[model samples]
Target: MVRGLTVLCWAVATPGLLWAAVRLLGVERGPLVQLLAFTPYVAGWSLLPVALSLALRRWWPAGVAAVAAVALIAVVAPRAFGGGSPAGGGGPTLRVLTANLLAGAGDAPTLVRLVRERQVDVLAVQEFTPEAAARLDASGLAELMPHRRLNPVAGTEGSGLYSRFPLTATGVRENPGGFTQAYGTLTAPGAAPATVESVHPAAPYSLGQLRAWERDLDAQPRATPGGPIRILAGDFNATLDHAPLRRLIASGYRDAADATGAGLAGTWGPYLPDQRHSSDRVPAIRRMAARITGDRIPPVTIDHVLVDRRVGVRDVSVLRLPGSDHRPVYAELALPRAELGG
Candidate 1:
């Protein structure tokens, strides 16, 4: 019994150790390897092996698992609990909200209510469908946000940006895989106009999709700290653990949630029912199970509000939106006085 238990402990510890090594090495070549990039997002699962090793009194295996947990914690803990830069002294504050409409199925009235309640200055939406756009327009959002740049597509590729300030449609960034992103300049009253992009990279579900997602992320323009203050807000389909997003951050952009110590809050999970299931009853059951289990699928933070270093992220929060799998992310930002067109 002792020997068998020891073998079981090793079996549990090896996989986590290997995954930790992969993350440390930053190897994202094939589909399987690319999937490993998300291991850190679910790093909490590593504790299972540690618990097992401790129960079996296997110190070496327990130590190995503990090290694996520590390594992952080292990677994620700073973002989860680290200190952010102090808020800038003088500048106009802009409150921005971003949401994925779940292919236009999100509740229009609920969204409008959020905008009004939060006093959002800029709103960015991904997976915008024409019907959803129509509903949003009719919900009095247009009156609140007169300046708009909408590119409503058939499916999940559509994107839109609305602002209380003036907006000039720059262009639509259409990926080869049919992923469309809309960007424009938002002219605030006292601040120099900033470029804002509604970002939604392709989901990396398979090898081809992974390649496309990588391409989409790599194609994003880098932010120039001293130049125009740029904001990229939407569902990135990649997390901080991904190498491409890390590179993007290294290029002078900062995630608003991270800046405000809200990075640990998850925005994506199994809240919405899976529409792909053949039977409606199955989806209902699945949702019920998820609710009962407290959504044990291990939620991930895929949606973000990224801004240039010159912008100060004063606060960040996440809201649950009806009819959507993702929670809406809102951030209050302040630009430096020099960038305020003083």
Candidate 2:
């Protein structure tokens, strides 16, 4: 009977331990498995083996407990070391819009219409191609957004900024080809000079890329323009679940949507196996719905608009936009009266 109980515990514990080990060793992929690095799931998995050993009054439980504790520690160590800031604080009011154009999936007109309707103050676009830029220009975007910045000219990881206020192109890098990872000055009519950083870190195909991007964001220089507000916006390609992202939170950047309880706005690959695809001529719309509903696996939030603590964000939302694999994130930031000098 004792042997049987021990076998039962081993049966449950071994697989959990192996899975945890694999993730820790970087043997697995995807955002879901990454959580084993810090989530509480590891503790529950390690407990059964410990209980079995304790029942027999053996030294094995100690071993089990030590291993389990280590796994838990690896997953949560970043946070313990002060990796993220408080939920939401600091910064003046700044409205923001972020979207990935998906290299012109034939939804430009609709997307332009949405931006005009929403009256988005600052717009950031990734994967923006020159053709899309032409389309946007034809749509009179230049009139609405007088100031603009473009990087990578027109391709993947390419970024651009369009704002109602005039943009002073400072700190432009030519090899990353004039893509100012840091750009934009606020021209919101008597508001402070806010600096906006538009970043699209290199996606992690391997552990190295992932780690580099993490450090890049963590160490990304901060620019203060005599303004109480700072804004960071773009396709991080990383989620809140990761260790590096926690550090961004620690740095006092406010995640607008989560702060306002806007729900998990996952912007990535769309289409579930069970999902029925529409025959509509526009693939962008069909795909956008697939992304929201998570027709395949669960949705993940990759794109984001993070604001500084002094800014009070009233609302944040996901909007369906044409010509992109990802939807646009819109946020309404409320400026403090003192910051506004009102």
Candidate 3:
């Protein structure tokens, strides 16, 4: 009985310990890349191993499980309570909204409505399609956000950046993952120029795409502290828990969601992986049905608004967009004054 109890305790406890190590040491690879997206959920479950080991009087496993639980919690807890930067009272405020259109299947009218109602100053879209672009413009997005740099194409390869302010030095760059990202220098009146991009690094949808995913994230442009403010917003396809994303954020940028303590909120997939980006054509009823049944599958935070560390993050919220698998992340940021040259 003691041997059986030891086996049971070790079974659960060992996996938690492994998860904690890989997460902290940034050693995740292949399928683990995809799996680590659920680290927040795993963090909560880590406690179970500790309890089991302790209750079974398995002293060795108990110590190990306790360490794992503490480590995982330490990794996840801060995101729930980070020090939010104060809004720059008199500085220019840029309200950013980012979403993945799921290959243009996200509702055009609803996306437009979000921009209008939220008074969004900049909008970054991923998985953008030419058809979706036309639909959005026709639905009055062009009027709301007149300035734009769009790379709308067929399928999920497109991205776009739309702003109310003028855009300069705009272009679309294709990442190693074959996704085109739209970028531009946004010059809002009375504020410093911001180089913003609609970022969509490759998702590690399969083990085959894992390397591509890492390369894409590694290639993201870093912010220079004394340079023009940079904001990278869209479906990053990575969460704060992922190592590559964390490394990129460490490079002079702060995730608006993390800065505002909304980091743990899920933005993608309460849907199955296969259904997460399915066509937007599925009727509203069916979509709701999937979500209701998918309550057991916890979503992950992959969409983000990463601003220059110097920028102030006033607020962050994850909002529902009915037709898309991903939720839109809206962040209100205060850009530094023009005098503070980079």
TM per candidate comes to: 0.87, 0.67, 0.92
Task: Write the residue-wise lDDT of candidate 2 on 1-342 in tens digits.
Answer: 877766665665565566556545544455433443334445445666676666665455446555765675465344223223232324344678887666544366766777788887788876666777887889878788877776635446456778887776444332121223536666466455666767666555355455555556565534232444577777766665555665676676667766675535566545232223222322454455656766444445667777766556777778776445566788877644444521
Worst lDDT run of 10 residues, candidate 3, spans: 271-280
Across 87-190, the per-residue lDDT of candidate 1 in tens digits comes to: 45257788999999877877788899999999999999998988888999899898988888889986688999888888885778887667788888886667
Q: Which candidate has the top score in TM-score?
A: 3
* Candidate topping lDDT: 3
Q: Model 1: runs farther than 4 Å from truth?
A: 29-41, 54-57, 86-90, 274-296, 339-342
In model 3, the runs with Cα more than 4 Å from the true position are 86-90, 271-296
Q: What is the C-alpha local distance difference test score of each model?
A: 0.80, 0.60, 0.87
Indicate whether candidate 1 or candidate 2 has the larger TM-score: 1
| Clash count, one per candidate | 0, 19, 2
> Please, what are the lDDT tens digits per residue for candidate 3 over residues 221-324?
98888777889998889988789998998898898888878999999876433345544554455466576766666788999999888888988999978667
lDDT, model 3 = 0.87
TM-score of 2: 0.67
